[model samples]
Target chain A: MDSMIQINNLKKTYSNGFNALKGININIEKGKFFGLLGPNGAGKTTTIGILTGLVNLTSGNVLIDGYDVIKDYKITRRMIGLSPQEINLDVFFTIKELLTFQGGYFGLSLSESKKRVEKLLYDLGLEDKVNAKARELSGGMKRRVQIAKALVHDPELIILDEPTAGVDIELRHLLWNSLKEMNIKQNKTLLLTTHYIEEAEALCDEVAIIDDGKIIAQGSPKELIKADGESYINITVNKINENILSDYNIDINENIIKITSKNPEKDIPNIINILSESNIAVRNLNVKTASLEDVFLKLTGKNIIDD
Target chain B: MINTPFLTLIYREVLRFIVLYKQTIMPGIISSGLYLVIFGHALGSRIGSINNIDYIHFIIPGLTMMAVINQSYANSSSSIMQAKYLKFIEDYLVAPVSGFELSMSFIIGAIFRGVINGILIILTCWMLTDFNVHNYSLSLFFLIITSCVFGAIGVIIGIISKSWDQVGVFGTFVFMPLSMLGGVFWSVDMLPKGWQFITILNPLYWMINGLRYSMIGISEIPIMFSIIISIIFAIIFTIIASVMFSRGYRIKS
Candidate 1:
């Protein structure tokens, strides 16, 4: 697979002597929905800023579509659209005007810009708020408009820094469906950074979890969960037989059997069979499979939302 | 070659002032009108002509230049300060616009505002008093150069300013006092020898005198010297603003 974004030894030390990025490397393939998951100060926004030319890099190189971000900024910036984490819209302009201006910035003609703006607004459920100013809309409505602005020019790569942050569930699902459609049907490469682990798991093909300005783990959602995530099987029985379950890793309390297994699906039947053979008389069984959230907690040693 | 993004930036900036014309434009016209009513008419009656021209007519060009300077500076500086504080400047930063293009766009927008306000004040003078522009081209040259000078200064201030108070400091303390002491309402010859020396050192004096010379065909200093000084101010400020913008000084991290 061809890489759309290639970052090598990227480092950023802010003017105030804060180390935002400590030589991180990231490669995102074309047409892939990639996610960067990290805490609030984990350099996610700084990385996005460097890619979009809003922030200068302290050292190292970043390339988009084979063009260096610094050397060929015009070409690189023209190929990517960014929806920043902050609500930074020009409040003076209406939603239609703002999106139209954004398209114009990417070299779209007036008619072409208007057409794309209309289509994006309709798809984002912001058609009614098109004539309204950004300040007039609710927070969720403004988030939709931000997405529409990013998609107006039809850039090849889209960088969304917390696109669904602070939005309601309904709007979040709406944005998710639209983003998935763009990735699947249009073959647009998407780079997303989010605090929501489930969002990353559901939308991203691959995810890199960064902590303290370093990428701690990188893989598909299932791969990370399988490799680092822990699953548990808790079986409640009328009576516990310790010797029959001695062949397995089991923690037994008076009448309950707790088993830790890497493959919960394969181990549950075996455990049940052994209990049946030993006449343990199992009453209830509960299996807990590891998810992306669990994997994140285990890797970072804290919740993604922890400040 | 036409650059659509650059043009769009200029258009957006120009539209910003137009959308807020009540704040950006109305105050200048109203203030200039008051000066004409109270200072030009009532004060002119008490104070006779100073340089073979009527007092009311003598202040016309100075008032017009004042409009150009104030509007030009206000447009660029306020526009940038608003964008900065509101965090909408990221739109321009992320775009394909080069630093030079971004600087020029804001300057061009300032020029439009300066020229528009200058023309409106000139029209206001013609209606209220016997004022006529003696040299149309020279008057226009002064209008444009003065706007360029102040517009560039506005950009510099906007980029370096961290607060709204800092943005207003230049207009209140520097430009306002200088405009008053720049021979706007009186001739430099009326001052004492030492005060005259101090007034000549003021750059605003040259700009106001240059525009006054164009309007009334009279100036205390040579018209060519005033033109050179105005151009020098424009060039220095433009270069500083362009360099600051290109370097992303205080704007990008």
Candidate 2:
């Protein structure tokens, strides 16, 4: 497996003695969208900070394309681009100025920066906003500009920290499509953290579910569901008769009763006969497969606030 | 991606203030001009002939350096504090740019503001009194170097402060009193002998003396010490501010 980033037993203990990352080990392959899933304060930002060389780590190492981040910072930094959670920009600067300046920070000549800025603005649907001040940009455009600024350096690895939060569905799809193109067309390695479970499930080929500074589950979304057999049967009684559920083999689960017996069809007939005799009618029945969100909620036990 | 460089950083800082010209530059100029008008009206006529020069001529250097120092300090302190408050400074942290680059950028921005203020003050004073600034080279040298030095110190203040309130805390508690007592509008020689010695220790006193020497061709303190002290303060403050930045001192939070 060709890993673009390999973090080994990564740990970060803050000055106040908060352990943000605990023995985290993960390998991200090249040209793939790797999702780092966690509830708030589960240390997603901290991990991103460490990988991008912003936060100091107490122990362990991060290797970006086999380049040690600490020992060889220049080369490692050149390989990665970080779109931070905060929209930090010189509000006085125009979008074109910001991108060109960012390009210059990467050592590109004026003409070269100009070329890159033009292409990026056009690609990110920011061509019309090239002259707009950062303060004048809408929230979605600002987020896109942030991404464009990061891409100005043209790094192989791009780390987006919650890029889709507070954005409308149209902009979300726009961002996702651009990110997908970055991965599939340009072969960039993208590490994105998102609040949208659907976004993660639809986009990521692999995910790590972190809770309380530990990885509880890490696998493909489909494989995670398969690994747990996250499927269920639900049967609701029509009438208000508790007796239908009692004196029966059907397992009760809140409003919807359940049964995991070998023969659901055979068991249904018996359940119907017993419910009819007790004056309880069958209202609704279902056999459903679990979604990625169900697996996420079950593993992490925190509602992922899409807002 | 842009490669963060020393020049790029400097350009950004310069652009930062220039684009927001009113907030950074105009107040200093207008304030200095008002002082020139008010003080030139009230005191210039009464305290005549200090070391064979009119009161207004004697005070021009002091008022000019005063504007430079205040503006330089405010620009650096306010900009950094705002960045910190808005949580926007992490952009610099993740970049390959070194701490020295960031510190120098802010300091240079302060210098830019200070120098512009000094020029405005000098121009206004020239129009009001037409004072034949006796030694042009010395006055120019002192103004440039002093503004640069005080501007660097502003970077130190910005690095040390946590909030906008802290700016007032430092400015009112320290800069205001020290500047007033530094003999901007008068001579230390006019004071009692004991107080004169205390004036020698105030760094702003030497700064004013250097400017005085340039404008009126005389100074209470040796012009040599004034020049040397300004350069020394510049080096000390630069070293301190850069060290704070390099260690990631206040930026992490």
Candidate topping TM-score: 1
Candidate 1: CAPRI quality band: high
> What is the alpha-carbon lDDT for the whole of candidate 1?
0.90
Candidate 1: list runs displaced more than 4 Å: A243-249
* Per-residue accuracy of model 1 over A135-206 as CA lDDT, tens digit each: 899999888887777888899999999999899998899889989999999999999999898899999999
* DockQ score of each predicted structure, in the order shown: 0.85, 0.32
lDDT of all predictions: 0.90, 0.80
Chain A vs. true chain A, TM-score per candidate? 0.96, 0.85
DockQ of 1: 0.85
For residue A101, what is the lDDT in candidate 2?
74
TM-score of 1: 0.97
Poorest 10 consecutive residues by lDDT, candidate 1 chain B: B124-133
